[model samples]
Target: MSSPLAFDPARMFAVFGMRAVDSAGFDREVVQAPGDDLRCVFLWGKDCYNCNVFKQTAMLHKDALLDLGLTWFECNVYDDVALGQRFSLHGVPAFMMFRHGKRLGRISGWPGLPQFTEAVRRLRSGPAAPPAPASTQ
Candidate 1:
């Protein structure tokens, strides 16, 4: 019989192929635009209950990640304090999506699956361009 699992963030993520990244790794891979494509970093903490739940919920739909076509990374912000500071993150269980070395958007907290999915959709679409100024004519 299989034994119960302990909350090892790295091991948990490894099961689904999310490479654990440190702040330097994040900057080199995600922030540097490894391929000028969307890169997503799942920021989490070691002792945060919500982070654990969020990770579980995300594990349910691993394909949702593949469908998004972005590189996936998991970071233990509780351990990598510099990462949290780089993004001005004040909390855990956040998803930061970046492209071309710029942040597209972020979904902070684990409200629920529906809200999270919708937020991902918006972030995937990326920031909207500003409207052109109207002429007086």
Candidate 2:
């Protein structure tokens, strides 16, 4: 088994086997670059409890997620303050979806594995984003 995370961003990326990107990468690769695959950018922060939970739970199933055909990248909002601001992110463990260098949608927290994956699936295949839960409306 892999070592447990120590709340360090680099360790977290290595542990989760996720590609870590900075604001420059986000702007260049995500905002400007074109791609056929749908993209999901995971936004996380240091020492975030929910982030750890999602990393251990939802992110652990990323191989299955990849099979569903969306590309994934992660960013540490704690280090990339500009990235957080650019997305208007209010919390850690969020998801920012994109398609062909355009914004698609965002999910603000770990909303359980099934729901989150469903959202990702819908975003990748359909034109509409998953509707906000009634509680948020």
- TM-scores of the candidates are 0.74, 0.75
The sequence of per-residue lDDT tens digits that candidate 2 reaches over residues 8-105 is 43443554456778987777877676656677788998778888887766546756655766567898899999999988888898988887567889
TM-score of 2: 0.75
The total of clashing pairs for model 2 equals 0
* Model 1 quality (TM-score): 0.74
In angstroms, give how far residue 6 of model 2 lies from its true place.
9.8
lDDT tens string, model 1, 1-137? 54576445455577556767897767777777456566678899887988988777666666774576667788888888998998899898888877767777887887786786676677667644434689999
Model 1 poorest ten-residue lDDT run? 123-132
RMSD of 1: 5.0
